[model samples]
Structures are given as C-alpha cells and as structure tokens.
Target: MDVRKRKTILFLGMALFAMFFGAGNLLLPAYLGYQTKIDWTSTFTGFSLTAILAPVLAIFAVAVSGNYFTDLGARANLKFAYLLAFVNVLCIGPLIALPRSGASVFEVAIQPILPDAQPVWVCVLFFGAVMTASFSLNWITGILGKIFGPILLMFLAILIIPGLFIGATVDLPPTIIEDRFYVGFHEGYQTMDVLAGLIFAVLLISGANRKGYTHINDKIEVVVKAAIFSAVCMLLVYGGLFYLGAHVSADPTEITRSSLLVHIATQYSGVNGIYLISILMILACLTTAIALTAGAANFFERLTNGKLGYIEGVITVTLISTLLAIVGVDGIIEYAAALLNFIYPVTLVLILSVLLFGKTIQNQKPYFITLIVTMLISFIRVLVNWFPNEEVFSAILNVLPLARFNLEWVLPAILTFVITCFALGRNLNLKRNQPF
Candidate 1:
C-alpha cells in the first residue's frame, strides 16, 4: 500500500476492465433490458451473476491456485486440463471474440457512416493494427491501463450520464419471457468473459510479477484487489446500460442488439451521441482485440513449449481472426452461442470446484467425475436444442432439476461429486501427482 503499489493496482484494475468490456459487454445488457422491460431487475441480477460475479471468481480461483489456468485446470488431470485450456483460448480468441470485435465495430460504427464499406477491408485494417500493437504481457497491460482504458471510460461516461435522465415514455410493455431470470442467465453466457477470465488471469499474474510483487501472497493480493476493482467498474457500466435500455422506446424484434445500443445512444445525446458511440465501439473492440491477440500469443508459445514464438503466434492468430471477421458479428454470435452453451456449464463447474474443494480434494477422481457428468449433461442439452423434436432427448432433459432455467447440469454435477466422494471414502484422500 505504498504510493507506487497503489498506482500499479489502479492501472491494473483499469486494464482488466478494458479487457473484459468488449463487444458482448457493450451489446448484451441493453438488449436484455429492452426484451425484459419491467422484469429488468431480475434479469439484470441473473446477468450480473454470470457476467460479473463468475468472471471475478475465475480470477480469484487462479490467483489462489498460485499459478495460471493450467494449474487450476490440472486439478482434474493433465490431459483434460490442456484440452480445456486450448478450447477456452480458441473460443475467446480467434474463433469468436477476436473476430467479433472487428465485425461489431464495422457493423455498428463503420457501416452506418460508410454504407459502401466492405467488412473484409475494415477487418484487414483492424487486424493489421492489432498485429502491430501486439506487445509483451506487461507492456500490453501498461498501455491498455494508461491509455485506452481512460479514453473508453470517458466515452462511456459521455453517453451514460445523459442516459440516466431518460425514462420509459410509453406504457411499459408486458414481459414476454415467463422466466426472466433464466433468460438473463442464458443470455449471460453470450458475454463469454468468464472464459476469458481464465486466460486473462495469466496476463494479470505476469503483470503483478513484473511490478515486483514476487511474493506468492503478495501476488494473490494484488490480483484479487485489481479483479474486484474491475468487477465494480463492469457492474456500474453494465447496470447503467441495462437501465438505459429499459427506458428506450424501441422494439427489440425490430432492431438488432448493436443497433439497439446505437439507437439508445442517439436518443440520449442526439447527433453527438452517434459520434460518442462510434468512437466507443472502436476503442472498446480494439482494446479487447489487442488483449486477446496478446493472450493468445502467450498461450501458443506456452502450449508449444516456446516452439511458437510470440510474434509468430500474434501474426498467425491475427491472420485467422481476420479471415473469420468477414463473416460479420451476427453470424459469429450465432455460432458462438451454440458452442458456448455446450462449454460454459463445464467451465463453471471446473471453476467452482477449484475454488470450493481445491484445498482438501487431493485425489483427482472427484474433479474428474464431477466435470465428466457436467460435460455429458451440457452436451445433451446442446443436442436437445439442435434436435428439438427428439422426444426422448427432450423427456430426459426436462426431468433434470433446473431444466426450466436451462441449467440442468447443475444438479447432476453436484450429485456426481458427492456420490463419488462418498463411494471412494478414504481412497479419495490419496495424494495427487502434480501435473506440471
């Protein structure tokens, strides 16, 4: 708590906020509010649980584990740990998030101004910028924390402060969804920051180390404090936007999510609103894209045991992300939704298990059993969505607890862990070999 330490924590917190507040963070809450209307409170609660609370917990879990994501994941076993790491990184990096950043900026910020602009060229230019800006972990955080983070916050403040005066002008519409909390919970999956948190933890730890917090306890303290700071900032911004959305007089069905945000911004501040939001989208998306590119490069070099150089990884990831960006935001979101549904429950289980049982649960069997059951149930749920008419799958899934909430995996994962622990008894107390 010296002056320098406080300054480091402040900047780290700002950088973490910038990294998490990406395309989904900007777009989802307002749309959820618009859809839920009078039910905005309950829906926002559910959204904040996954979107805000879960990601912060993911950061804490890694910090407590005294290592990066691999150590946390290796609680199950080395193979499963590595598999989840790669999938989580790819999902948040090139496949979905990285590309969606550019695509969203194009759709929301660019296309409206330049009707003739092609997304391909915009993406190429965007990724080219990302590639050039890719720096070491500490440098990346320093730049985002000191520069982009403040500018992004300033842009948000310009729009959101005016938004508070805006209220529902029409007869507020009735809620369309019966289970508003569940709908919010389901929508929260689309944010995907919880998944990003696992990897962002790596960057945070490295940043702390270079800042000279070399003691293990000191490292955990700085990371946890910074994460809490980020969580507060996210809740404020997301809550403001969600409240603003509830007040906007627009049809959710008539407008796309990104467009809905644009509409609200314009309503709040008029022509100047458009300018603020356009700039917001570019800075927000660019901050996230840059962070993801750096994070991905770090992961690849680690995965290949340094065979893949950091610069090479950055170039390769940018190239792939550039190609995928051409598909546009909605298309990427459609694909990401399905994939996230399948993976999120499993990831949540892993994070919660580590935080809850990681200290005493020495044997990997319990973690293994719990995660496998979670994955099986989650996969079945995804299949049920894909083939809605399959009576057998529907019948089996509906029987699970929380099915109405689209969280049917929760009960089974808990039951499986308990049953496995009881069945194994003292045998479950066996020491686990270190994965590393």
Candidate 2:
C-alpha cells in the first residue's frame, strides 16, 4: 500500500478502536478480572473470542460482502434483511446503545465532577455535538481516529500502566466461579460490539471509499488491515485492564463496575486518577455516541431508500437518545439485556454464516433455514428467562447440546444449514435429471 492509503488505514483502525471501546468496553473486562481473580486470564481468553474476535470477523463479513449490514442480511431475504436492520438500528442506536452511552457520560464523567449538573443538558450538548458530527458522515472516521482516539489512548495508558504495576504487587485471590471461561464468554455478550460491528463497518467502508479506496479489492484490503490493527489495540487494553482488576487488593464483591474502575484508578494515583478516568470515559462515550449516531442515520436513510434524509435521521435518533438518557442508565441497561439476549445469538449466526459459507452457498435456503432455527432457539432461550418457572421452555433447551454453556442454538443452526443445503442440492439434481 502507498503511504497515503497506509495513513488512511491507520486512521480508520484508530476510529474503529475508539468506536468499539465505549463505557461497557471499559467496565466489563475489569469487572470480570475482579470477579474471576486468578482465573482472569482464562476469562479474558474467552471474553476475547466474542468481544474482540467475533466483531472483527463481522467487519470482514461486511467487507467481503462488498457493502454493509443490508447486503449481508439480504442473503437470507430482503424482508429479513430490512427487519434485521431495523431491530439492530434500534438496539444499537436510539433505543439502547446510544442512550446508554449518553447516560454513561453523565454518570461517570459528569456527575462525579459536577454533581449539580442536570443530565438533560449534558445529554443535549452531547447528542447535539453528535448531530453536528453526523452531518459530516464522510469525516466521522477522521475526526474520531485522528483526534479523540489518540487522546483516549494516551489517558488510558496513563491509567492502566501504573495500575497494572500496583495490581501485580497484590496477590490474587481464589476465583469465585468454577466455570471461568464460560462466565467470561457469556459476559462478553454484554459488550455488544459484535452487533455494533455490523453497523460501524458501513462507516469504515464509506470512509475508505471517500478516501479514494474505491475499488472492491482496495476497500476490503484497507478494512481488513485496519481491523487487525484495531483488534490488537483492543486486546492490549482489555488484557491490561483484566490483569489489573484481577490483582486488586480491595474487596470487589459489593462494588459496581464503574466503582471498581474508579477505585482502581484512585488506588494507583489518588485524586488525580479520578480526573484521568473522567476524561478517559467522556472521550470513550463521546466517540461511541458519534459513531452510533452516524451509523444509525446512514442506515435509516438507506433503509428508507432516501425517503428519510440523513439529517432528519440524525435529528430523530439524537432526540430519542437524549430523551432516554434523562431517564437514567440503569433502566436502559436492563432493557438492553432482554433485547440483546433475544437478538445476539441470531445476529452472531448470521455474521458467521455469511463469513464462512456465503461465497460457497449462493442459495437463500440455507441462510433462511439457519437463521430461522437460530432465531427460534434464541427466542425460546429468551422466553426461558422471561418465564423461568415454565417447564416447557426449560425442557426444550435442557436436552440440546451446549445448552449448559448457553449456546443451544449452535448445533441446531449448523445442522439446519447443512441439511437445507443437502436437501436443496439433491432436489436440484433430481430436477435436472428428470425426463421433462
């Protein structure tokens, strides 16, 4: 690659990193470390699979498909594609993720520093700025990657480096959980980056195209390379946080995720550390909000086939997100959990199916069948939570392989795809050889 393209890749990678490394991204791994204790590394290993690896693969899935989320989803069917896009936009956009980021900013970055400040105004300014940035969709990557990303990284390094040293000196406690890997793997779902990946990859590809990497080969090459860089950056930061949280000397059982992070910060650097964390978190929240808003706006604009203008879409998303932010973060999180559990497994199936089998399996039958099986299984899994006492729901999943691991959909999705493909191919052969 030429120097200009390399620069573009670096910025794109940084932008992607910033976009992914939001409030939950900051909180989850450290809390996992705090909880998992000596098994932190094993837990992080599992966490990395879904949190880091799956997201990068999702990006590649979109890149190879030669477009964004819609193209990949279209493999199943247009209606399914639109429905998936709409739900994903709501989950990751105005309804859940966007508001959650705004709320986090107020909780972590604002309230601690300015206890008297109203969340409403804070969110207004935040999403107002997000709206402004979304106006220049072409420049989202540059603004975040070139500016906020570097500052976020610098502050994060300042916070994690010494904390890691302090944590290293403290002996780790015995793990609280037996199934550390499974816990980490399951906990990784809370990050929600894999879902975000389907959306953000559009921004990256659009950004790449605007930067003159227009050819499909060049676009994929740039995106894939940038994804690798972003993945490495995420791994390093997450690993550092996990190791630091694992060796924390204080009792972490009662503390919340944000509290544990702040406690660790003060443990290493006192009051100055609080300010550092505040800055780190604000930038993290802002970067993520910007990306989410832009992606949602772009998605809706496209989803409507330009009936909803990009500016109008941004305004709508920002208005909804800001209003929800005022209602507080906790409720948003609770709402998101139910919605995520319902959609996450199915979305993962779609991403992996596209990435692994999309090129070879050109037919829609396998995609449709696999997705239906995954969705039905995921729906039952969600129902099991909603009606835990209902034996019908529990009994259905209890016999499925990997149900104990909370992955009841995997075997069924795979078998459905293979069977559908085999059946379709057999029928095609029979028709071809028929006398008529």
Highest TM-score: which candidate?
Answer: 1
lDDT of 1 by residue, 282-370 (tens): 99999999999998999999999999999999999999999998898889998887789888998999999989888888889999989
Q: In model 2, where is the ten-residue run with the lowest total lDDT? A: 427-436
Across residues 1-436, which tens digit of lDDT does each residue of candidate 2 receive? Answer: 6899899899999999999998889888888998999888899999999999999998999898767787888777767877987898898898888888888888878887888999989999988888887888888899889999988988889988997767777877688697789888877888889989999999999889988889999999999999999999999999999987887767656687777777788888888877887888889988998899999999999878899999999999999999998867677777677788778888899989878877677777688778988988888888888898999999999989999888888899999988887888754222111111
Off by over 4 Å in 2: 426-436
Question: All candidates' TM-scores?
Answer: 0.97, 0.95
Model 2 lDDT at residue 306: 100
Each model's C-alpha lDDT?
Answer: 0.88, 0.86
> How well does candidate 2 match the true structure, expressed as C-alpha RMSD?
3.4
Superposed Cα deviation of residue 108, candidate 1 (Å): 0.6
